[model samples]
Target: MTAELNARLEPTGERWTLVFIRELRKPPEEVWGALTDPGRLERWAPFTAERDLGTTGDTTLTMIDGDESTPLPATVRRAEPPHLLEYTWGDDLLRWELEPSGAGTLLTLRHTLPGEDGLGPMVASGWHLCLDVMERLLDGEDVRAVRGEEAKEHGWEDLRDRYAKMFAG
Candidate 1:
């Protein structure tokens, strides 16, 4: 299946915010579980949650691949369950907002980066694949985590080129 690259980039002061909006066929609560539950996240997320992330606290996010799969310290800035969640990962902040839309959930992800720095398209491409995997999972389809060479093999390079053009101006 062809992945859809539907993220928007906005300049926010010294930083740039990349927003990904998705309309899921599942409800907010179900989507929330996928976002917070470790078991469900492992099927789609790029990292595994070491603990429950439904509360505002600290947790470890273990990288799913790479030799540097070491757990990273992460802080939950806010959590509202089935609605809103904000957290920090490395030098960036990630926020997820869910809202009921029709019979499904409208999920919005706001990823704040220090700067555009030519990484916007690359990052957007990665998130595009992750979100695609998540949506497929929610739809009850068997999907594997896409990354590295697998990502490029599955049209990630095309997405990167599209996003690069989108973020160019």
Candidate 2:
């Protein structure tokens, strides 16, 4: 992927918000299923929801892998099915907005960090790859979740450098 398609970061007071916009060749409903359905999420997302994340409810999102596999508490701030879904992942807030665009869906992901941290590039790179995997899944490609070393081996470092430059200034 090119740097132009990379996530864009904006300084919001003490916090930094990253926005990733992708035009998918699928309907909003299909994309929404991939985002909220645990089965589909496991194919690409870093975590899996304990409960159905399709409504305005609370759920536990268990990290796929980590030193401590503790489930993080998450609360749905907004859920409008196939349109908008906002939730809190630990201290950060993630908002996904979907709209009909031509024959496809315009998906926008906004992740707001609690503060300006040097980990922005890494996080952006991870999400960049995650989104790419998600898109490939939607395109009927059987791709598995890529993280940690697997991510680095899949050009994540290059993405991280590009994202760092984009977020630098």
**Per-residue CA lDDT of candidate 1, range 99-140, in tens?**
999999999999998866477888888888888899899999
Clashing pairs for predicted structure model 2, backbone only: none
Tell me model 1's lDDT, rounded to 2 decimals: 0.85
lDDT per residue as tens, model 2, 89-145? 888889999999988899899889887757688888888888888989998998898
Residue range with the least summed lDDT across 10 consecutive positions in model 2? 1-10
Clashing pairs in 1: none
Return the top candidate by lDDT.
Answer: 1
Residue 40 in candidate 2 has what lDDT?
90
As a whole number from 0 to 100, the lDDT of residue 37 in candidate 2 is: 89
